[model samples]
Target: MDNLRRRHITSFQNGVLEPIVFDDKRKSMKSILLSSIKLQKTIAPVLSTIRNFYNKYYNTIHPLCFTFLSFLTRFYLISLSDVVMWDESHFGKFASHYLNREFYFDVHPPLGKMIVALAGWLAGYDGSFDFESATRYPEDLNYTFMRIFMASFGVLMVPLAYFTSIELGFSKHSTILVTLMVLFDTAYLCISRFILLDAMLLFFTLLTLFCMTKFHNQSYHPFSANWWKWLIMTGISIGCVSSVKWIGLFTTALVGLYTIEDLWNKLGDLSIPKIDYLKHWMARIICLIVLPILIYIGCFAIHFAILTHTGPGDEQMSSLFQAGLIGNDFAENPLEVAYGSRITLRNTGFGGGLLHSHVEEYPGGSGQQQVTCYHHEDFNNDWIVLKPREMEIYDNETDVEFVNDGDTIRLLHLATESNLHSHKIPAPLTRAHWEVSCYGNDTFGDEKDSWVIEVVDDVYKRTNHIRSLTTIMRLRHKVLGCYLRAANVGLPDWGFRQVEVTCDKRNNPKDTYTHWNIERHWNSKLPPGGKANYKSKFLREFWNLNVAMYYANNALVSDPDDNDILASKPRQWPILEVGLRLCSWTSDSIKFYLLGNPAVWWSGTASLMLFILTLFWYLVRRQRQYTDFSPGFLMDQFTASCSLKTKNMIFGIHYALIITIFWYFKDIAYGVSSPNIELKDKKWLSTWDIVD
Candidate 1:
């Protein structure tokens, strides 16, 4: 057991053992003592030398020595499996996208993937491999190098935890307890050995925590160079963690709340000068808010700069942004909105999309072809602009009529041959709004099918004449007096998850979602729009992209139709109620079980519970005015905080007993070319459902 301690101590050269010289009365004692004498002579010098070396160098090299051991634990047999595990498949593909100079979209922010791409580049990977789940890597892919580089981030995490404990005023043995918990956490070790973003995410998380505590310590010397440095570093770490994943926001929020409380305390200090207080507020605002924002934006800028090529993610962006991509030709759209011209209407909202319709009718409300806002363009997106009439066809002859502002026009779906119509029936998703749908053929339509155009183009000029790709306008339902809008209200399954389009009754002048722009107009009679007309500022595009990403992320829900073994509720994570199977379960494949060392995880949970109970106990006593903590009662307060360094040995004894538990489960992390039946003892924890 790793917890086993040495029971025997070496004797000093001048002490212990009677001399070898024996009399006849003690001849038998001579034989017994001779063997012991030879044993001491053989090993005593070596044990003394080791003890001297440890005593002399332990303090100086312990961190380095143990950190190296941590690395070994993570790196050992890391290459045993050449297959991508768990989220590595997803992240690895994103890395290849970067290496190939192609754009892609993900729910997370970009810095972690960008670093993974950098890792691939440094590893000499040429972006040729597709990382399919459970797929073995190719010989020349150099995944090992990338993994090693990524794991380097994880390696720093152990030391970060160690130093963070010291900064938090943990005693020597308490610090060892903290560091050892991190060191032996199977989840941390195994996760670090992969080409996944968690390694960086967790490293930055720990770094942020460490910097927060370190900065708190420097609060004693406000505005000092060290204080400012740590404060700024804390902000940078927050930015990095956030860039890795949205989960980082939890840590950022923790620091933010603490800072708020700190500032509030300082504000109430009557003796503090107003100027110094102002400086404190200004410093925190600049470092905590502005600095992190700059870092986050800088990372996105790098993301946009590197991904200039047209990609599958183009559909998620505005037509203007798509046009700016290297291989997209979306700018070659007609400039004028002539009658009979087929066009796509783009809602001007932050994350709005093209007006779309499908043949599926609403299950509720006015049963008609579903009208929705769709990010992707398709034939269903094409709507023919026509004069407000019941005409079956329009002639694109010499006598042409261009749709203008204040002109009432009927929109006919090119693919479905139905007129865009709105009625008083409440929209399925937005109950307060009118249902927008495609109803009736071109030959048969009512006044409800007609919409009045109100163009409000650019700042330089008022455009009464509608211009494609540049004019901003609103489509008002002629009879109902509601504006066509798309506010990212998702439709039901019958509507295929597209955003609901409704005729909003509210006449909010600044409701961008209610505004419409004619994009990708097609009329053989009109001139094509110039690419210059479609240019957009990076900030505008970035803002809209994030909005779209937020909406998309919000819409993500687990499928109720399928049983997902890998997915677990938040409650299950703390106690290891489920273990994520990282690869296919087979006799031949190398498998990784994503479970933590139960001893560490459970102890952490217990500590949190203990803290809550301790707080409750103190609060109850305070309420009753049991405040005479002169000497005897005062010691309990110190003990409650666990700040008494005098009892470290007791703490260490308990820590080692916990470590023995961790030692039993080490194989689940270190090597499992194939998990044998015996290791099902991994099911040692009642919560681990590893067999399936």
Candidate 2:
């Protein structure tokens, strides 16, 4: 009774009295509820005012404001310094090639370079800059215009993002949020403010997604001109995307999937006739599949037409292919091959380089002077072909002397005054075979250096002349009974870091490296067809280029020789775990880092996961509510008016995954346009003669 001091306290409500228990916990909870209500009331005015501000200015004026901000942020101080940053050396050189109409090979498609070239050309650039080693820009060069042009694409990304959000029916605030994320991203800013392909890539990617979403919204009005316009635009955007890099294929795939899903849903609609569904499928096949392919091939065609003259890409292409180029040597008349001919042999194997010899000695296995395969054209790569015991008897004037099978021969290196010889000495890199070295004196080489010509087939084995661009032959060493081969391994400095060549006993004529071709042959006599019969086929040459590009892509992705230091695995990209060194000045003077923004990248990753979870949650809830989770129903539900959050989530996840997978497959962030950094131990690119 004494402890219950407040037990008799009662509250009067509606003229009724009731006993009230004095509970500290209950009172505290009531106080918290009242404070929360009061706080909500107090903030209501501020929230309404903020909403009113957004409603008043966001739709009409905000886009322009965002564009202004993006332009200022990206373009301000863009010409901060004249020093080359990141991939400017590579891309700038490519652009110059375009302006000069110089043919160059790259693993990527040509649209991005073409755009850069167009920009530079419009800016009064004379196409004379080499972009060598981050050298200073020329005084007359309008370098700022080029930088500003590239930044303009980055500027466009902000509005593109904003428009994309709006097209997907997102709220004004949500659109602003998305725009701000892209505008403020440090990675996008850094990459876009330079003359690189990334900004263009991002622009196309965003444009593609926007067009795709617009197309999706018009699905109900299929066959409408507006629908076709969006679909066609999406296809064109895909071409632009792929023109930048092969990574764009991921986005293309997503669009394809979207089209398939749309068609599948249209097929299931009971009101739509089967013929209507067929028409829809046909339209997509034409617009999505065939149209994009044509655009892609068209880009290549334009690329080929613009770059008519030969340049640095000559070695990467086949000898026949190079001969067809306008300014190349073979452009005049195809040279014929004959016995005792001075020629260069290029192996069509994995590395696909020229047989070469230099003064440098082998460091690892045989202590002889190194014999290797180089890709570029060099005087050192020239060799004199001689048939043993016949070279002295035969003269260059002899009527098309044919060196047939079973003929003993020797290759004398013209530059080093040494015979291309092989003995029982094991190869340095490929130990299973004998070693090939520049051995014996020039003029009169050793008997041990002799080799027998072995044509792979019976037709060519019967005393047939080895013709250039016609016959494939192998050189079998008489002493070691082995065939000369390229080992696909780089040698030390002595060999100019080119792939090592060896003599292997295994005679797999199918092996590309062992099968040799006469790349360049000198003979006064003309072939049966004559020079007029020589013709270049565009389709065949294009196919060959495709093959070359495929091999180049494989080498970069796999890093088969483990030479690339900047190559990162796919898993490292999402967490912002690695950064590439764009450029360096000595050890500490200045450096540029190619790193993604931590905040933007991490948030994208988080958004991707959250979107996936939300999608699953929505699907599960739908399944539980309807208990009829049929494909048609689910498709219709998704195609219908989805919530803004759901729409954004889907697009965001798709966008993130597309980019992530693309970068994963490419392995390198800057594509082939970026200069590969050289380390003391590892070499990224095939070694070429350093031209002064």
Candidate 3:
């Protein structure tokens, strides 16, 4: 190539008289200038052809080819590592529950699991896999069906991202870049191939952003059916996104902001009538908030309907609530309440448990029998309600006496045959009051063991009975002048890790910690039809389930225990400082690791940071340029400067970052501040990269 260039230069010199050009410097400069112009004219066509070719390939063919390759890679060997990885155990079991029409509880909403179940059902999964942790999947289980279902979402993400970039006004090269980033992300791939909810969440979130981008690009054509389609699709996608995980709310928020900005732009348009603002408001309200909520509720309703038979999740709900489900023991016939009834008491307090006693004595102080509140049901949970004074059986009359509010009673533990007694001893945990324990002789009680029943004010006017499903009451220790409080804190090992029971001096009637309700009652007078009305039962059960879920989610503690060295933090995510162990072979020869690819993740982080800086820069420049602006006028100026497409993309990036951070905190225990640790050794980590 060099020799050819030299030959061409010599021929050009021979043709143009090189000696004259060298001899006269002033003429040589002018001659050189003219030759340069002639050379540019000759090369312009070639450069333009090269530019056109680059644009054609990068803009037209690149994303298409990349998306095909992404799908191929995601679908290939996706089921090679045939084992339950990380959370697959939990989600797989949830899928099994849905297939069997059996109810189960989980921290997340049911849409993702329902999808998994639907895929499995379609692919011939018999709901036989136990989905236990570290267990090898049976050969007959429909693992590939569920995995392919999840991977499909991942495969779809590439094209969705590509179109979203185009909608955002990105060049062909930029769109290709976006497609490649999502296509090759290792963490995303790993999550997609597994039976987990995160893949579904990502899919719906991307779909939501893509639909919103479409809507934004078509905002000028509001009267068009395409705009309405995109708007409704955006709302439905939001519902699906949020149904998979609450982290999806971030995407919903971005859509909302886009709608607001779109309306604001309309308000700024002097050509449009002011009354048109009302139309925009009505359109957005119907499409964004109202439609999404309906779809969201519809998802839950479908979930409840499909999981008709009772299963493991029943224990989390109330006994009365469970009595309404088709397959629960309480659904058919419930007994009436009567005095001296053998019953089970349940507290409605947060993390509150049933009053229970066992043969084990207290750990150290006072060494009396251990009495505590347990969340789970056990034989020891049963108790007998007896009046303060022992009554002889009136052999002549067979009518049973009913217990009531303000009735003084003595609760005798059914298992240990000890009275539910309170004394002056300090509580093991809540030290401000007296300790509660079962401390009386068998089938006998002392005055100190007496408790005065005070039904919660709402039910106080009515007579108290064991069959009163809505009853709430408190037990006041007659001798201690205090209320029996089921302190939410757990006791040490001696108490079997049950919640501590204490006697509090403050007799607050409304204190949930001291409230107890009768759950199971035994009497012969009740009819057979009972309270098993499926529709109302489902509603009440759903409400209670939501309440419990809300409480449990908010009450989650983020402080890791001493043994939780593998816990991750939100801040560590951006730096790729940690990885989750997905699965490992029992022989230690193979493993799967869940971590993001450095090339994809770090570049994305950098790009997002650049986006943030660009946004700030744009805002500052806009503010400085537009000085004489009203509040609405300034917003109008801002919207005009940043087109809706660009604004949606920016907001989408922001939402992605926010959701990632939100999920990190929600899933991982991230309350503690810890020093950032770099991955100093990059040795054999790829051995666990199942995709490789």
What's the TM-score of every candidate structure? 0.84, 0.70, 0.76
lDDT score for candidate 3 against the true structure? 0.72
lDDT of each: 0.82, 0.73, 0.72
Top TM-score model? 1
Better of 2 and 3 by lDDT: 2
Tens-digit per-residue lDDT, 382-402, candidate 2: 887776643465554746666
Sort the candidates on lDDT, descending order.
Answer: 1, 2, 3
Candidate 1 lDDT over 1-692, as tens digits, reads: 34433244455566774333324435557877998999999999999999999889765566787699788887888888888887889889999989887878888899999999999999888888889988889999888889999999989988898888778776556677778888888888888999999999999999999999999999889999999999999999999999898889998999999899999999999878999999999999999989998998889899889988888777666666776778877677876678878889998785688999988999989888899988876899999988877544456387667777898899999998999999989999788999999999978878899998887654225666787766788988889999999997788789889999999999876888988887788888777676776675678668867877777787677787778776678998787777776777675666678888888888787766766776677778879987633322122334555545645655766678667866877666765765456567678666575654
All models, RMSD in angstroms: 8.1, 13.4, 10.2
- What would the per-residue lDDT of candidate 3 be over residues 1-692, giving only the tens digit for each residue? 32222211233454683422123455668999999999999999999998899776765676678678767867867666676777889988998899899878876777888998888888788898999877888988878888888888888888888889888876443565567667766677777887888878998999999999898888788758998999889989998998888789999998878777778888889988767778778888888899988877777889888877788886676656566667765534344456656778877776567788899887755678887888787899998877765545334346777777787888888888888888888888888888888877655667888898887833223544534445678889887789988857888776777888889999787787888877666545444336633123446556666667777777665666644534777887887776765654233323555677665666667766766665677678788894443322122334456766886675466446534533443211111112112121332344322222
Which ranges of candidate 3 are over 4 A from the true structure? Answer: 1-64, 221-224, 257-279, 331-334, 363-368, 390-397, 423-425, 441-448, 452-470, 478-482, 505-512, 524-536, 554-566, 585-588, 612-692
Model 2 residue 547 distance off true place after TM-score fit, in angstroms: 3.8
Error of 2 at 35 (Å): 40
